[model samples]
Structure formats: C-alpha cells, structure tokens
Target: MKKIKLSFDKFKDSTIYLNSSKSESNRLLIIKALSEKEITIKNLSKANDSVLLKNLLESENLVVWDAQDAGTSFRFLTSFLAIKKEHVVLSGTERMKQRPVKVLVDALNKIGAEILYLENEGFPPIYVKGKINQVKNKLDIPGDISSQYISSLILIAPLLEKGIEINIEEPFYSRPYVNMTLNLMNSFGIKSAVKGNKISIKNQEFSSGSYIVESDWSAASYWYSILSISDNINNLTLQGLKKKSNQGDSVISELMKSFGVNTQYKEDGIVLTKIKLDTEEIELDFRDCPDLAQTILVVAAYHKIKLKVSGVESLKIKETDRLVAMKNELKKIGCDFYEEGNYWILEKRRREIDDELSIDTYKDHRMAMAFAPLASKKSMIINDPDVVVKSYPTYWEDLKKVGFIIT
Candidate 1:
C-alpha cells in the first residue's frame, strides 16, 4: 500500500492550480456524444472520472471499462449506454461493485432496457442489454435515492422520441446535483424544468458545444476547513470558483461563515479570510449536499465546536461507511461522534491532538483529502493516498503548492 505522510507546522502563501470539475466534464462528454459533433473542452478534469468518460467514448467492441472507483462513470455511462442500446458489461473496483445500482437498474427496466444483476442484487457487474425503443415520457423515480440515477436519466431525456418527465416521490436529496445536471444541459443547448417535485425535459437534440469546467467546489471545502482553523487566512486564495456555481457544495461559503471564514468573491476565484467570531453549536440538514459532510465534520471537530448533522443516511453507501470512518477516527483525536435518533452530533470534549494523527482512507478519496487539511493544525499521515485519483488527481500536489510538505 502506498501512503503519503503530510507534515504541516505552518504553510506559506503560494498559488495553486486546482483540477477542473470531473462532474461537469463527464456530463459534457455525454452531451457531446449525443450531439455527435467535435468540440474542444478546456480545463477538463484530469481525475479518473473524466479519463474514463473520455476513454469510453472512444472505445468500441467488447469494452471493459475499469471505472477505478469513479461513481459518476458507473452511473452516467450506464444510462448513456442504455440510450445507445449497446451490449456491454459495466463493472468497477471491488468497492464499486458493492455500491448499489438497483435503483438505476430498476428505473432503466421501467424504460424498457434488458438489464440483469450479474453477481448480486443492487450491486455492480450488471449485464446491460442496451437499445430499447420507446422510452415513455412520464415516469416515477425515487427522489431520496442517489441523484446519479436521476442525472443519468435526465442526460438522455432530450434524445428520447417522447421527452421525459420525472415525478419525484418523497423529499428529494442532493437537489443541487439535479440542478447541476440541468445547468450543464442548458450549456449544451438543452433546457429542463422542475415544478413541484417534477422535472420535465422536452425532446430536443443536444447541440455540440465546448464547455469550461469550473474548479471543484467539493475540493474547495478542504481549504475552507484549513482556513477555519488556521491563524492566518490572508494567504489562501482558492482559484477558478464562481460566485454562481452549479455545484451544490458551494454552500460551504455560507456555512463556513459560522466557523469564522469570511468569503470574498473575485474575478478569478474566491478568497477566504479568517474573521473574529464566537463559535457556537449549529445544526443543518445535509440531505441536499451529502458530500460536504466530512469536510464540515473535520472542521467542527478540529475547532472543538459542537454540531448536529442530519440527512446523512447515504454516508453508509458512499466509497466507505463514512459515518463509521469519521466516528472511529475522530475518537483518536478526542472527539465523540454519536447518533441521536435522526441526528448525528459531534461533541468536542477535549483539545488534545494525537501526537501523530494516523488516518485510514478506506479506499475513499474524500476520507483522505478531507482529513488531510487538518494537518495544518498538526502532523498527520494518510494511508492509500492514491485513492484521491477518484476526483482530485492533483490533491496532494495542490496541498504542496500551499506549502504542505508531503513525504
């Protein structure tokens, strides 16, 4: 196992070039495929997700796409293939196989796709028999499930002979994700509408177009965490983030205000400055933005702040059981993460940092990257550092740009 040990006494000011958003890049790849027109995308994500999307689009005949733990690839391609009606076996890493795809499979079945669960129900390695004609326009898909399923269907909606209308049952989670899909669709000359838990897209061919991917807002949250705990915030300038971003994790700008990070909008990106504020206990429903859970939890624990979090049931199905990972690791740093009915509370009982904070990444990229920012407070080692290739391939390099020494 390859491990990267990060030492941080204090970091100096330096300019960092962050990777572009894999989410946007993948969505655009599907759009371009539908458009069947050649276009140039600038600053595309170098992460594995974008790489898989690019490769799969170019490959033909008996393709075994090693998604390498890219969830977006597993899902977006699943729907993309259903539209093209190509016979392919979609599989990923062992951990990816464990991630449930039953929701998407069932939805695709309703739309007339021949899909069989290869190994087990609700898991990967599904044999998809693609190319079924006559996908109905109106359908009921669960809203509380992974938004990837919804995004998958929406990406192909415009191509269907009958435009698709999705009726979302129950309160939707990851709403920002659905909105991000719509925003990207619009950029590619397609539009969608949401009215009372229903999203409708009219039948229209996607236009071939070039798209510029913004820096990942999810990646920026780590810097927000470091700035929240660091004494000097004047040095951190996160570039390529937009004030108006489709990424839902941009809520970090508003949520981190309570943690003492003042946000400033710039033409290039946003600047985070430390401010004077009395930290207090807070509560939020993260159902709309589950990806932000780890960054917020680490920031809360490192600051010794009390926090109540909800809408985290999806954490169990992510790259790792994030709730369990956080609970176990936070205990090493003298913090207690416990569940109370529908809420999980982070109680900071002590200020003592473990002399050498050792972390297990559990093959989850976020686990390694999210916790690494805490090293700004103390020295730490992250196991399985390469796991970050799932999203931010340059994560460790970007940290080094900010004066973090990795050995």
Candidate 2:
C-alpha cells in the first residue's frame, strides 16, 4: 500500500496489550547467546528488529547475516559475531550501511576481535573474521552518545577472557541505556561497575534463568500522544507496562503529564486518562531518552505548545535524519522547530493540519507511530505505515481497536 488513511474519532475507552520491549529482548538474546547453558526468555518482542536479531543468532550456516534497518541488531550482532569467532560477513539495508559501525568495530578490535569494514571505513556491511586473540582489556571511545555502541561492547564484555573496562569520554548521551545494559548483565549473574564515565564488566558465566520482557514504553508513547490530544477518549489502557522498568523510554509517563495525559500505574499495565493541560510551555532533554523525541515532538507540534528541547542532536543519525524529517513533516501541519541558542523551540502556534494531510515516515518507525495520533485531530494518510512493525508491530491494529478506521 502506498498510503493508509486513518479515519478516527472519539472513543470512551479502549485497551491494548502493548508489544514487549525490543530493547530488553534484544539485550537478553545476546546474553543468552553468550551463556554456557540455555536460558528461557519470555515475551520476546515481535518487532522486526528483535525477531531478526534472534534469527541471526540462531542460524549456524548463514554466511552473511542481513540486519536490515535494525540498528541494535546490527551493532549487537557485530560484537556477538566477533566473539563467536565465526568467519562471516555482517550486513544490513542500504541505510544501515550508512550508519556508523566503526565505534563498535574499533572497540571490539582493541579487545582482540578482528573485524573489517567491508565498505566504508566507518560504516557497516562489515566482514567479521571472528579471530580473537584477546589482546587488550581496556578501550577508550568518544562519549558523543550512542547507547547502542556502549551496550554492544558491554554485552560482549563478559565473554572476553580478560574481561573489559571502557572509559567513555565526556559529553555522553544516553546514560540510561548503558545502565540498562549493565543492569541486565547483572541480572544474568555478571557483576559490573560504573564510575564517573567508566564501566567495567568482569568475565563470568551468564547464569541460567527465565526473564520476562517489559511491555515497550517506547510503543506506549504513541497511545499517550493519542490520549493527550484526542478529546473523545475517556480511557486508554496499555497492558504489560510497568511503573518501574529497565527501559529508559519509560520516562514517557512523566513527560506526557504536561500534555494532560494522567497515567495510573497498575499491577499489570498502565491506564491513560485525559486531564486539563497545566502549562503553556515545556522543556525537555532527551539525551537519556532520544527514542521518545519523535513522539513528544509530534504531540508538542500538534498542540502548538512552546517546547524547548535539547539532547536531540543524536536524531540526525537515526533511521532517517529525524531532525530534518521532523522539520519537513511538521511544516505540513503548520508548525516549526527552529533553533534558539542551544535548544530547539516549537513555537509560533499556527497549527493548520490539512484535511488531506499525508505523513511520510522516512523509513523510520517512530516517525510513523509518533504522528499517528494526529489522525484523531483530522483523518490523515500515513505513508509507509508498515514501518511501525520495526517496533510496534500491532500499532495499526491497536489504533483500529480504539475506533480508528484504516482503509
């Protein structure tokens, strides 16, 4: 389908069982791969990213594993393949080939894993010789802030014979992601330490155990966006989301408060109830939660709220150039994200959502779901709606359950 129009209106109440966290699922799968014994992981994400990573890890004969557009899968697999010492090539989609892999590859090589970039010097589609000599235990990488890079290295650290210590240079973004990785590694019985821009994980066997995945809070942000702006909604419940979660994107609960979405945390999930907007302006830093930027930006733009945000510099290298994409797409809705000093401001409240509004997803899943809620304001067409499968595979179905007509 070239485009799908979402015909939506008011709903009093609806419930959706949110998808499992691909973040947690992917990390655990890598841990499982490194484990000496089998471990059971419940509720792995159906997201294309996690599914691809799981399949690639399980395949023994495939010589070239295609990571497609999944950044986590590609970065994590790069490290995992090097550790397995498997002679194979790691590749991805055209855009994936453009995304940087040198940080992880260089770090892996420093620690004695031989990896060569098959194409560009810093990009992916790399050949992994899987010849490990265990040369070094310490690595120094720029902290310009890709949590995936740090997570990839840390996840494989335990498997290193000499263990590993990483010194992250300052100006680090996404600390929460690095912490999530360490926390998961600890849960698997591998102890680690973090001290002021440094991280260390000692060599240890991954303990066998069963772990359940939390519902994707990143996925839940879309519902929050819908409820925040949808006047016809009385109640929207998302199942399987925990008040306390290892996922960094769980911050959506706090950030959505300004948009008048009240979250009542439940034993099994979360309920979103609409409330009166409490403020005219909001300020946020997405360094630790970059994935939520698109959702929040969309919500802010839709309402013509003055939102001053930083930590979004990382968005440039995402699935698409999100900053540019946001600028262009938001332009369609009569909003602007112009720079002001160090922060970008979403001001000049002139929201003019077109009746024939059609949003291009730029091959970015967040772009598709973040802007989906705008349909509540006006029925609109979403291009490349299938992109949501990268994270929230059931996004469209969930929307349909809430009285959204897709045709």
Q: Each model's TM-score, in the order given?
A: 0.96, 0.97
Candidate 1 lDDT over 95-212, as tens digits, reads 8998999888888778777887779898988777767575556788887768889999999988887878889888789988888999988887888888988999988866676778
Q: For residues 1-407, write the lDDT of model 2, one tens digit per residue.
A: 57898978556348899999999999999999889977999999999999988988888788989999998888888888888857799888899888887888888888888888787898988998866679889989887748799999899888888998999998898888888899888887889988999898888888888899999998999899988878778778899998878888999999988988989988989889988886778889998899999899888887778889999888888899898999888889988787888888887459478896999999999999988898887989999899988998888988888888889
Prediction 2 TM-score vs. true: 0.97
In order of listing, the candidates' clash counts read 2, 0
- Flag regions of model 2 displaced more than 4 Å: 10-13
| Whole-model Cα lDDT of every candidate shown, in order | 0.83, 0.87
Residue pairs clashing in model 2 are none
| TM-score (C-alpha) between model 1 and the true structure | 0.96
Cα lDDT for residue 86, candidate 1: 63
